[model samples]
Every structure is written in structure tokens, then in C-alpha cells.
Target: MDTVTHTFFGLTLYAAVKKEGWSRKEKTAFFVTAVGGSQIPDIDVISSWWDTAGRYQMWHRGLTHSVFLVPIWAALFSAISWLFWKVKGWKLYGLGVLAVLIHDTSDLFNAWGTGYLEPFSTQRITFGTIPIVDLTLWAIMLGGLLYAKLRKISRPHRVYKLVWLLMACHFIAQSAQGYALYEQHAGRYEQFALSAGFVPGQFQMIGKKNGVVEISNATAFTEPKLQVELKSQESADLDKLFAANPKAKTLYEWSPFVVLVDNEKQIGLYDPRFYRNGQSFLFEAIEKDLKQGK
Candidate 1:
């Protein structure tokens, strides 16, 4: 999930739980710690230096995104936050951990999912169930925040409660969307097995890439592509695609990104074409790989 969203959700959750035993100071501490903890997952970006050799070295959504990390990361952040809490440290630590974990959970709803197990297993998770930016959820959550901070209404008012409820609904709806997509391809997983790859897991962002249905596997630094063909009915009137790539088309459906490069011999596809990112560097890399016959 977006950091901003995590922060907002964390803050709202903190506020909602304030009535328990946490004071305003403790709530504030929890919110801050959660925000920081939520960002902890991305610290793996530093591993790009290793990607030069092996893409799996420091996969993005790996162990850092794990549920197990929740306690560890939260405890880590809580310890840092505790240094400043100046009181019963456990409250801040507990609240901080829960809030941060919520932030991680919320992020699983987006396309750029995280890997909860980096040092362990390199797996990414995402549920296209809710778009990275869901307007309705945004409106309700942002509106609620605006009202809480702008309006002079009591914090415990019904309106504030509604915001939390809406956010919760969004999370559930997003999770369901992911599950639905997974089930949609459950039986067909074998069809696309050889051509490309299937995540074979839940909530990973699946997309069309360079004319092939691909799953953005964070396990690969560049996100190796996957190719999955859609059943005729699975596509939007795929009969028309019969003549497209004949061989590939037999399996593919109506995919806009799945275009034939020049419709020539065996070699097609060139979107954003390598030359677009700086021909010299691109050529150098391509040349280097070619020299090695990779």
C-alpha cells in the first residue's frame, strides 16, 4: 500500500483504539512508530547493487513483508519509539506493532505487492481486488480525516466511526477481488504453465506484458514475464483474435498490450523498445549479453 495510505490508516486505527488505555501521547507514539515500521519493508531497495549478478539476491517483496516480521519489525520500531514514550513501554510497543501490521496488511491490496519473506522465500503478494488508488475508499477516508481535523465535532462522533467502517469494507472488498481472480484461473493454471508462468499463489498482480500475460513476480528484480492464454469465453469476444498471432492467438484472447511487433518472422514485440531507455546503455547491455550468447 502507499505510504500515505498506511499513515492515514495507522493514524485512524490509533485514534479508534485511543479509548482503551493509551493516552494521547501513547497514541501519537503508536502512529509515528507504525508509519516508520510500514516503510521498513522498502529498505531492501538497497539490494539493487546485488541485482547486477542475481535478481533473486534481494527480492523486493521478500521476507520483509512477512507476517512474522510484524512482531519483529513492530518490536523494533516500538523499541525505538519507547525510547521517547517515557512511561509503560509495553502499551506503546503493542499499539505500534498492531498499527504497523495493519499498514502492511493494507498494502497487500495493491498491484505492487510486497514480499513478506525476503531472507527466507522470495514471494510477492498483491490483490488487484482494489486498485492501488480506490476513489470511493479514498473519498471516505480522506473526507473523514478532513472532517475530524477540520470540523469541531467530537472525535468519538458517529461520522468518525463511519470512516473506519468504510476503510474496513474496502480492505475486505479488495481481498475478495484477489481471491476471485485466483479462483478464476485455478483450473486453467496448467494451460499457461509452459508458455510462461503463473504465480500459483494469491493476490499477486497479474498483467499483460509485451504480448504475453505476465505476473509481476518480485522474485525477479526485473519481474520476469509470464504468458497465460485466455479461454475464448474468458476473453471479450476473442473470436476476432483468431487470425492475430494464429499460433499465440489460439491461446490468447483480446489483449490490447499483446500486439505483434512487426508481424514478421519469429521476432516480434518491441514496446518501450529497448532503445527508448537510452540506446547507448541499452546497446551496451544487449551487446554484452549477445557476446555471451545469453
Candidate 2:
């Protein structure tokens, strides 16, 4: 999820709390607890400055986003809130933990996955069922906000809680549909990647098998339609590429799946899931010496 969405999650979590009978200072502390924890995991972005070894690709959503780090972030935020507002309670710590959990878990639904189990495991877990920016979530949250405002409800927090229910339903629906489509063509492809389509229930499914890649659009209610087909030259020598662009090597290792390219003049690899229109931004190449690796 994007920073804005995470920030919204924080705000919504804060709003969903029943803060009645609390002092102004206490409310402020809880507010900081919710919003701060939500954004804190993203602190990994700062590692890019010191990353000269192409580890930034692995660092961006790395250790900081780890599930193991959730309680650590929560306790840190709780301590800060305790010092600043003198509001001491296990509730604050629990809120902080939930906020951070929401941040990390939401990221797993997108194609650009997070290192959720990092420090223990570097696997980038992604369901690729939801877009990085899901308008459906925005709409659901905004609609809840609007209804709460208009309905003269006794407990507006309930509305926000319902919004959470809606968000969960949306995620489950998207994931289930994507899983069905991926299973639909199960034994055919060696690797598969799913990208959420702009329209709900539609997905761009990328499958790679036997050095060939297939890109297609699939809908839960209909059969998949072939969109583009690409060939992957996996046998191409990547030693020169690894020697030239170290980041390319990191990308190759970091990505869940990739498309290898061995054009006439150069050899490279790119993530097929990011293939948009004609090219992929992840494409990394180095000039080829046909005779060297021959």
C-alpha cells in the first residue's frame, strides 16, 4: 500500500476507537500511537541513502517491515506516548501493534510485496490480488465517513468498524478470485504472477513456462483473453550483466519471477509482472560479447 493509504489506515483506526471518558491529552497520545506506528515501518526507505551495494532493492521493504518488528515498534511508540502524555495503559500498546500489523499485512496484497518475515526469512510474500492504490478501499472508507456524518448515529465508531468489515470483504473477494484464476490454469505454467486490473474482478495474469511467457486478462465470470506473449531467453549468459550492473544481479535474485532477454546486442532480465504496454521499468541490460560466452 502507498503511504497515503497507510496514513488513512492510521487515522481510521484512531477514529474507530471509542475514546469516550478520556482526557484531551490521552486522546492525543492514542492518536500518535495509531498514526505513528502505521508509518514507522516505512522508515526502511532511509536505508537507500547508505545502500551502495544494490541492497536497496532488498532494503526498501526489508527488515523494518518484518512481522517480528511489529511489537518492537509498538512498544517504542507506547513508550513515547507514555513519556509525552503520561497516559499509561496496555490499550495504547495494543493499538500500536494493530496499526503496525495493518501496515505490514496490507502490503502483502500487492505485487510489490514486503519482507514480512525478515531477519528470519527474506522471502517477499505477495498475493498480487490488490493494486498498490486500491480505490475500493478509499471509496468504502469515505462512504463510511459520509454515512456517519449524515446519520446522527450515537456511536460513529461503529461506522468505522463496519468500514473495516467492508475492507476485509473486498480483500477476500479479490484474493479468492485471483486464486481461482491462478488455479484455473494450474499445471500449464511453471510460474505465475497476478496484477489487479483497474476494474474489479479482472486480473492480468502473467505465466511463464518453458522459456515462454504469456500475458492475459482474466475475469472471474469469464474465460481469460490472451493479451501479449513474450519469449524468455533463460539460457543467456548473465555473468557480464552481473559484473556490469550489480543491481541487475540483485534484482534477478530479489524478484519472485523474471523474464530473461538476450537481444542481438545485449543480454538482460526484467520482471514480467511489471510489463506495461511495451517495456518494463525493471529491465536491466548489459552489452553482450557474442564470442565471449560462446
Candidate 3:
């Protein structure tokens, strides 16, 4: 999820707390715990400043977003709350854990996955059942907020809880549709990935077989519309490219599949899942003259 969505998650979590008899200080402490924990994992973004090797792709959502680090973050938040507000208990720690856990898990549903397991495993776990910026989720949250204000509800926490429930249902529905589309086309390709479109019930299905990659727009209630086909130069010798640009190697490894470009002018590779508008944003290329030391 994007930064805005994550912040909203933190806000919703805070709002869902039933603090009927809580003190002002206690409420503030819990608020910090919820919102802070939701964003702490993204601290890995700072690694980009020192990323001379182009490993930022691998490091951005790397170990910091790992499940192993969740407890550590929670403990830190809990200690901070205790130090500042004199509020110390399992409740603070537990909410912190929940907030951080939500951040890590939510990242798994997008095309740009996270290193959820980290040191234990470097696999990028992604379902691609949700877009990076989901308007549906935003709408649900906004609607909940509006309803609470208009009705002047005494227990707004209940409204937020309902918002959470609705969001979960949306996720499940999108995942189910994506899964069905994947299964329908699984046999046609050796490797495949799903990227949920910005619109609900829609997806971009990417499949690779042999050296050919097929990208299609699909939905559960409609036939998949063929978008474009990409042919990968599977036999391309990438030794020079990898040697000159280590990020190219990282990109190759981090992506589920890549379309290798080997031609007279240049040698490069790009992730097919992000292909768009006759090019891919994730493309990495090097001139053949550079490769030949010209």
C-alpha cells in the first residue's frame, strides 16, 4: 500500500479503540503507538541514500519489513510510550504489534512485494490482488468517517470497526477474483503473475512461456483482452551488464520474470509485470558500445 493508505490504516486502528474511560494521556499514547507502528517499517527507504550498488530495489522493502522485526518495532514503541506517558502494559505492546503487522502484511497484496521473511528467506511474497493505491479502500474509510460525523455517534469505534470489516471483505473479494483468473490461465504459461488494475474486479495478467511473455487485461465476468506480447532474449549474455550495473542483477533476481533485451545497440532487461505505454519503468539497459569498451 502507499503512504496515504498506510496512514489511514493507522488512523482507523486508533479510531477503532474503545477508550470510553481512558485518560487523555493514555489515549494519546495509544494513538502514537498505532500510527507510528504502521509507518516504521518503511524506514528502509533511507537506504536509498547509500545505495551505490543499485540494491535499493531489494533494500527498500527488505529486512525492515520482515516479520522478525515486527516484535522489535513493537517493543520500541511500547518503551517510548512508557517513557513519555508513564503508560506501561501489554495493551500498548499488543497494539504496536498489530500496527506493524498490518503494515508488513498489507504490502504483500501489491505488485511490488516485500521481503516478509527476510533473513529466513529472500523470496518476494506478493499476491498482487490489490493496487498500490486502492480507491475502494479509501472510499470505505471515507464513508465510515462521514457516517460517524453525520450521525453524531457516541461510539465511533464501532463505526471504524465496521470500516475495517468492509475493507477486509473488499480484499477477499479482489483476491478471489484474481485467483480465479490466474487459475483459468495457469496452464498456458510456465510462470505467471497478477497485477490488480486501478479499477475493481480488473487485473493485468502476465504470463511467460518459453521466451514469450503475454500481458492481458482480465476480469472474472469477461474474457481477457490481449494487451501486448513481449519476447525475451533468453540466451542474452548479461555478464557485462551485470558487471557494470549491479542493480540490473538485483532487478533480474527480484522480479518474478523479466523480458531480456539483447540487440545490436544495447543489452538490457525489464520486468514484464510493469510493462506499460511501449516501455517499462523498471527497465535497465546498457549501450553495446559501453559493453564493448568503445
TM-score of each: 0.58, 0.95, 0.97
Models, CA RMSD each: 11.8, 1.8, 1.4
> What lDDT score goes with residue 87 in model 1?
38
Q: Please tell me which predicted candidate would have the highest TM-score against the true structure.
A: 3
Report how far off residue 158 is in candidate 3 (Å). 0.2
Lowest-scoring 10 consecutive residues by lDDT in candidate 2? 285-294
1-294, model 2: which lDDT tens digit per residue?
A: 999889889989998999888899999999999999899999989988888887788888889999999999999988998788888789999999999999999999998899999888888998889998888888988898889889878899999999999999999999999989878875689988898976778888888889999999888779889998999898887887898888889898888888888877888899888899889988888876778853
Model 3 lowest lDDT segment of ten = 285-294
Q: What pairs collide in candidate 2? A: none
Better candidate number, 1 or 2, judged by lDDT: 2
By TM-score, the better pick of 1 and 2 is 2
| Superposed model 2: Cα runs more than 4 Å off | 288-294
Q: Specify the highest-lDDT model's number.
A: 3
